[model samples]
Target: MKHNMFCFQCEQTAGCTGCTGRAGVCGKQANTANLQDALTGALIALARTIQGKQTVSAKISKQIIDGLFTTVTNVNFNDVTIQQRIDAIHRELPAGTADYDMKKVWDAQEDIRSLKSLILFGIRGMAAYAYHAMILGYTDAQLDAFFVKALCAVGEDTWGMDELLPIVLEVGEKNLACMALLDKANTETYGIPEPTTVPLTVEKGPFIVVTGHDLYDLKCLLEQTKDKGVAVYTHGEMLPAHGYPELKKYPHLKGNFGTAWQNQQKEFDNIPAPILFTTNCLMPPRPSYADRVFTTEVVSYPEMVHIDEARDFTPVIEKALELGGYAEDQPFTGINGGHTVTTGFGHGAILRAADQIVDAVKSGAIRHFFLVGGCDGARPGRNYYTEFVKQTPPDTVVLTLACGKYRFNDLDLGTIGGLPRLMDVGQCNDAYGAIQVAVALAKAFDCGVNELPLSMVLSWYEQKAVCILLTLLYLGIQNIRLGPTLPAFLSPNVLQFLVEHYHIAPISTPEEDLKAILGE
Candidate 1:
């Protein structure tokens, strides 16, 4: 049953099993996938060499983070760059340290593989957050230290579930700290996000579309494009950038270009502006727009103009100016057909309204609170989220985050009490905000988070969602309904363990799941 390559870290993995074929569902080729594994193996070797030592350096720590981030779903599809990263890891490691072959972990026993995959993939997700935070000069010593330990553990063949399971949860606990670090870095750098409405219109003349989750990259592009006769538009997860005080201050940061990340291939096919991918969410570009693609940081695709660490965005800006956008303002709408979406209902914004939310729950104006959020993907059955939001019965409130909110963020869900029925809580990393909001509400309501009139019906597509789910489990939150499909990597024993301990279940139809939650 062995195919060319093996990967199941994303929700859209082939056949709900591993994508053990010529190319992954995300368009990652078999060769590139192997190179990513090689890079990870090298990084693990690097970590192992320095393990239990007092002198771990920051540059080594950052390379480990970058190396792990490079292997995440949809990040780097260029085998050339991946091998370069592997070479870099090799040069950085001490003399005679051998790279750990990843095939051992991949070909291990079923439950053993599953548990180690959780720890491995969970830390892979955490690396993205740590990378973002490090770029902002907000590094956590403990988080960096755990990255080394966890990578070593992944390559440690002797470690069983008893050892691996606790590390899996530790990945979540550290990821929480990592996320909080990134959150602090973001708010301190960009200011606490405020509720702001983002338009869906692309203004005339030259402009650039910036996708991916890196706020600093977008900030750099915004600064460079200002008054240079080019405007900037946010796409996918970058939609939340408009809510930050510093980011929103730019008048040239005009509008959002398209829907979530999954639709980029269709939406960017003939767009006049050049697209800058700052991080993950890159799919294989079509020839029509391939010339317009530019990548920065760890996101790389072959033949795309890769922006270097100097951060000079001249190529992207020139490409935009040359392309010359729409002749007139072109209006676009969300997946729900609405022309505007709102964001920045993050933790600070929500907790500021705690008194009102508490009183509304007390008065029965807000009947149930649903966290209908997580990564959105292109799989079939995703419309369940759309339908679920559409049928939320008006008395309930929907709190959403990540790109999945694009499913219903534009809809006029109206108001429950005085608050809007649907609230957009920024990017996927803002799950930290969602966590903080839930805990504060639980405190105000005088009960645990699981006992609050809140339920989590989440849709996941990648490792970021994995770490977040583990965080919820670590917090003892129960009964999370996850779909469009559960992770393919969860073996039967691991699934049973999660079900028995945390009560996580695969999402069924929206109506039936709603009855279960609302009935409770």
Candidate 2:
């Protein structure tokens, strides 16, 4: 088929293959997708050039990180913005080396292609965490250096599993450090998140729904809208905002809005209030709700109002007032018809209750722990997650995050050992919290995280998920079941490597996978 471009990097790719027409299933124009690929190629070339150089400045490194992350699915949907970033990267190079062709890496041997994809995609995800940490004044040299090393490895041909395996693990290892940096930044800036309950119903009157994965933006919005008669509610990945002491202190920071990222199109339809997107997972806006959609920081959509560095949110406030919302307190519920959703079960909160959790485990009150979380997408088979969570034994603890939780978050899974079996652990970025809890559990049992009676059933749809997966691999955590399907970008050889090294498997039906996971 003669197509305008190729874009299969996401779950919504056209025809279950690469998007080769005028626009992607993700609504990304062909030109924009190609430009993203070009930006990524330029980054690889820059990394290749600086592979052995020990004198690269932090400014150059930051540009490389930002440029790669900007190309990630749903991050930068605007061609003009991506081009500007490409030019910025070119300007940073020493002006002597030829630009590396990205198509070469994409067209390499299946094995090499797969290995490189892991390193590349893993770094793309890591950059997001690093960017978030950077915004909070946290930076790590080791974490920054890995991006360069991993990028250079993607362009290297001498690597096989024996050589690339460590790099793959390194992505996970470095991502852990990156996540830690972000954790420190977030906790230091917003205070440790405590257990918090966020309602699903939107309070009547003027209110703004803040989506995306940035806490600082949410904090800024809460600060700006204070005393303005405008209420702020978390949406999508922002559901965790209620946990942070600094953010929750705001009296007007109301409950969550909508569900997962994929459902935004339908959920936001005719929504009276303005919605501000602060990061990735933004879908193309529908006309009915387009006027109310706003972008801030790196998230940009055509024709949407964008709040700049000034961080002024007056436009959002005005729109909220204009919308007026519902005249009465409109009651809303989650997919499972629950009127409330609970979040903020972060590491600090979980570990504080560690004694209870350990006692439960020792008494056999909590038999198995399942961390069922990841990005949510439009794929049809993704219902497997909700079904999987539903099928979990009553004695199991279900810890979830990202948009994936929306599939089953509303379900009343009841409790085990005085803790809600289904625990919402904040957003995808808060995967750091899940890691902390797992580590604490292992420490309590005096075993490795993998050795604990814990399992991670993850579903990934974008780069941020990739970084978290890498962090998991880095810690040598094994027996993770990931699905609804593996990325087509992964070659068979690379798949074999992951299976042999980490015992990662594709998800099956809930019943079958559950038996396998539980050794039934």
Candidate 3:
């Protein structure tokens, strides 16, 4: 079937196949999605051509990575902006080379299609982390080259489990490096995060809620709103901002406003504050609150206020003032009934007390470790996350990230050696933190991360989660339980490959999955 556009790359694709008609489930027009695919094809060709070149410049590499990343779901929802990226990639490549048709990969055999999808979606997700790392002045050669390698691999016709297996793990491996680079950038530019309790109450008066995964944007917003009588509250992934010393230092920076991204439609309705979305996980806006939603740095929604390069947040600030927020201080609680949440358990903070953690584990004070986290969405069965956390043994510790934790983050799970049973390791991007913690524990215990009694139970709702999953797989981490629903985009063969090789399983009932996770 001929498609004007191919959009099976996201979880919300039309009818569970490629969205070929006028628009995608994401509301992206056919022309815009086609432009994005063409841009991706051009990038793949450029990457393939540069694969063997030793002289590829950082500028070219950055453009390729950023271009692919910008095309991800809900990221670049504008046709004009996507075309600009296409033009930029075209300029980077030497003339006369034919661009690979990205649709060809999408239309390949189910198995080959699945493997390639992992590479493509994995990189798209990794690009977000790489982009964040670049903003903070961190880059790794392996990470950059992997982008080229993965893109080139997607264009290759050779398809075997061996050929595909390495690349699949490579996606995971490169993602780890990319995430590490981002972690370094974030921690150095900001600082190692410490445990911080964030309130859900929006202090009365004017305030802005910044969402998405960009710290730089949050920093910019915090800087611009300083002393403006406007309180800044975090939403979605931005909830972790409360953990950073630099960001939390702002007295006007109040607390978090909403829960996960999927709930924004109901949550943001009648909300009397402006929201600045700096990156992914943006849902289609409801008309009632659409005017109050603002986009910046590649996150675009049709008619919302778009904050441009000058980083001037004048309009967002104005909206906050105009909305005037609640009549007085309003108290909000998480889904699990807790009035507050805590975050900032980056690797540095966790490792700082490594000796204690090791001792606790050895003395049977801390038993199993469950990394329960990922992107949260509107899927009906997602409450598995809440149940997963609730079912964790009392002697176990849970590490979480992204907005998924809103399902259970509020629960008072008590503590292990002075550390809360639940540790919020920052945003989804902060999966790097969880990985770092795992690696450190492995080193301390003299075993691979896979053998460190750590099990990952992840729930993915978008491309960012895909990249993080690839990273975990690349690190040879095994037996991860992923749910609430497998990506509709993954072909059956590819799903089989993941299951056979990585032992990755889909989530079943919470009780059954919990027993299996505990090796019962």
Candidate 4:
């Protein structure tokens, strides 16, 4: 039978290949997958139309960014919202615009599909960063212009690797700029994040659980609910909110409610609190707490309460009060059974202690740096991350971010050079911060970033990780370790090219990879 849909973008693809049946591994329905495909085709159509114009305006840029981000894995599963996006894109076209069938790209030669997938998925990740910055009143003309260029390139049939390869690296280059813009917007608005300890327990009282990576939305919710009886807790990617100075000051902004995004269906089911989704990583809601789930910004689902541009969170707030939370304090611990986690070791915080870190390395007090970070998912192979961190040498430092940190964030790794051994940089967008720290260390040691005794051990579940990986490659950083499995879209030839040029390796056991990385 012909496939109902095709998606292989995230880490949890079925059978280590694309999902091509009635439903995706993440529980996305076939129709939802079809709409996502249609939305992407429409974005490509919109890009083709925009290419003919003399100047691509900011309004057009926003539309392209919005459309791209909405189709990312676990972002939007609502047919109504996606169709509305399709209609809106159609409205923007001058005339005679038709969506380029995504099947064409999917059916292309394996190498071609690999390159194009890189372009398409890279931009999808970049779009999330651009959207976050735009919400905070920051926009880059160059960054916006590239969206039009990249989308148009994805639609071009005659282009080969010679034509598409540079664009892939450019996606990395532009993503760095986009990440910087988002980092600037966040730190300037919320104040630089500091090392803050966040409890996993949910305090007794009416409470709201806010998830996703949008800190601005969380800040707004904190403002509106201030002086009210409701308490607010961060979930998943929002866990880093506790480290921001401005956000942590809120008395009612209590702590994190659950672990990563994949566990939400079980964690939030019939819970006493309401949950708000500010951006992506939204699973299709379970019937138990579907009504209590609210969405805003680019996140949407049918029948769920959506907080619109007005940002009025009254509906979500009222639901929190109605639930009235638990009768008493409920203690929750991380996967490691620890009651608290530490975060907010952002670039600034890390750099401020640069001298101590440098001295530690010089004195052999710190042997190496392992960046064990990225998104988390449901697959059993993901346990590799927990084991890897557990097996790291005591003298090594671990820097992590994004939802993946939840795997072992609660573990007490002890101190290195007066700084916590494991430092939590903000969100995935804060990969810029991680880059900054790496560059500074390289400079301090008079060497290249890859030459600074630092290695990247990354786990990816979504497009955001794709873009970050591309950025590292663009910077000519080498010997990176990626797992639990390689992307299915990369055919043999393209995979060979990456292996020869970048030395990228599929991860093995914690002991083996650690020995290899440390040159044992």
Writing each residue's lDDT as its tens digit, candidate 2 over 1-520 gives: 3337776667556665577888888888888888888888788878887777765678977887788778778877877778888888788778786666767777777777767777788888889888888877788877767788888887776676678767877888888888888889999999988878788888889999888888998888888888999988888888888989999999999898888888889999999999998888888999999999999877777678888978998889999999998788988898888998888888888888999999999999999999999999888899999899999999899999888999998898898898899888887878888988988899999998989999999998987787788888777789999988788777777778779999999998999999988999
> Model 1, range 40-159, lDDT digits (tens) per residue?
899889998888876568989889999999999999999899999899889987888888998998899989999888988898899999999999999987888899999999999997
Show the colliding residue pairs in model 1: none
**lDDT of residue 117 for candidate 1:** 89
- Give the least accurate 10-residue stretch of model 3, judged by summed lDDT: 1-10
Task: Please estimate how well model 2 matches the true structure, expressed as its whole-model Cα lDDT.
Answer: 0.85
The true-versus-predicted C-alpha distance at residue 205 of model 4, in Å, is 0.7
Off by over 4 Å in 1: 1-3
In terms of lDDT, model 1 sits at 0.91
Q: List candidate 2 segments past 4 Å from native.
A: 1-3, 157-162
| Per-residue accuracy of model 4 over 404-475 as CA lDDT, tens digit each | 999999999999888889888978888999999999999999999878889999999889999999999999
Once fitted onto the true fold, the runs of candidate 3 whose alpha carbons sit more than 4 angstroms away are 1-5, 12-21, 94-97, 158-162
RMSD of 3: 2.3
Q: Using Cα atoms with residue i matched to residue i, what is each candidate's TM-score against the true structure?
A: 0.98, 0.95, 0.94, 0.98
